[model samples]
Target: MRIDLTNIPSEGKSLHFTLTPDWWKSDLDEDRLMGLEAPLSASIKLYPAGKKIAVEGSLSTRLVMRCDRCLEPYGWDLSTDFRIYLSIAPFKGELDVELSEDDLSLDFIDGEFLDPAQIIREQIILSVPMKTLCRKDCKGLCPVCGCNLNMTRCSCSSTYETSLYQNS
Candidate 1:
């Protein structure tokens, strides 16, 4: 939803919004989030300051991820919280400098309607974790016997969970 800052308060205005999962386009990362089969849900607050908008909120969703050690699909929960500022000032020849959000600085965009879908895409991408695990001591599938060691036993001298990291 677009927040027209034409006549907002100087001290900023408090606004709350909830966005559903259907608002986003599917951006599946085959490598991450397992098979990339889930969408993010958003709850946010906006504080408008002149032509600047400060956003803070959280998005939660369920992810199907591959077990880092076993290569099996597992259910993983993911959530992303964001606190960022965006400037919606009109472009004038008076200033031609690049904008940034470093160290809680500033980011500039066209002084037009803001697309909520774009905001969601950015938030979701930034929230993904670099690494994920099924469990701290997950006994993954057996390599030799092709059995899920966590659920079944293997007779062959197949690799075990504890042995996988013995060298490390």
Candidate 2:
């Protein structure tokens, strides 16, 4: 999904589209997003601002992910509304110039085209949680017998459990 910013009007153009599971290939190394449980719907409005462009939109989708603890599959719902300002002109300042606070979120356009796929991929990556668990109270697996604690209780003495977390 590329948007040509060369002829964008001052009032901007509003566009709406859907991203299906077949549209994108996962590039994550580990704990990757398996697929989309529902279609991803996006609505964006691009407008010209000076030598830059402003992008504002919202995207929502339900993703299938693998649990880090039990390695089981699960569904996670994600939705985000983003506002970004892009600059098409190159910065001619010195190489050693220090960045201001506003430079943190500023984006640069490439050849008068705005690649929405890159933006969507970045947003999805940022939205991923550091830790993925099926549930907060997940008992996990038994260290001795490798039994799922959530399913069945192991006969390994309770002392083993007490000693495991004592040092931590």
**Judged by TM-score, which candidate is best?**
2
Q: How far is candidate 1 from the true structure (C-alpha RMSD, Å)?
A: 5.2
In candidate 2, what are the lDDT values of residues 24-109, reduced to their tens digit?
56755544567678888888888876666777888899888777655667889999987766665455411121122333322323
> How much is 55 displaced in model 2, in angstroms?
1.1
Q: Give the TM-score of candidate 1.
A: 0.60
Q: For candidate 1, write residues 30-105 as lDDT tens digits.
A: 3654433456566656666445666666777766667766667787776777776655447541212222433221
Error of 2 at 76 (Å): 0.9
lDDT comparing candidate 2 with the true structure: 0.68
Weakest lDDT window of 10 consecutive positions for candidate 2: 93-102
**Which residue pairs collide in model 2, if any?**
none
TM-score to native of every candidate shown: 0.60, 0.76
Error of 2 at 70 (Å): 1.5
Q: In model 1, what are the clashing residue pairs, if there are any? A: none
State the lDDT at 48 in candidate 1: 69
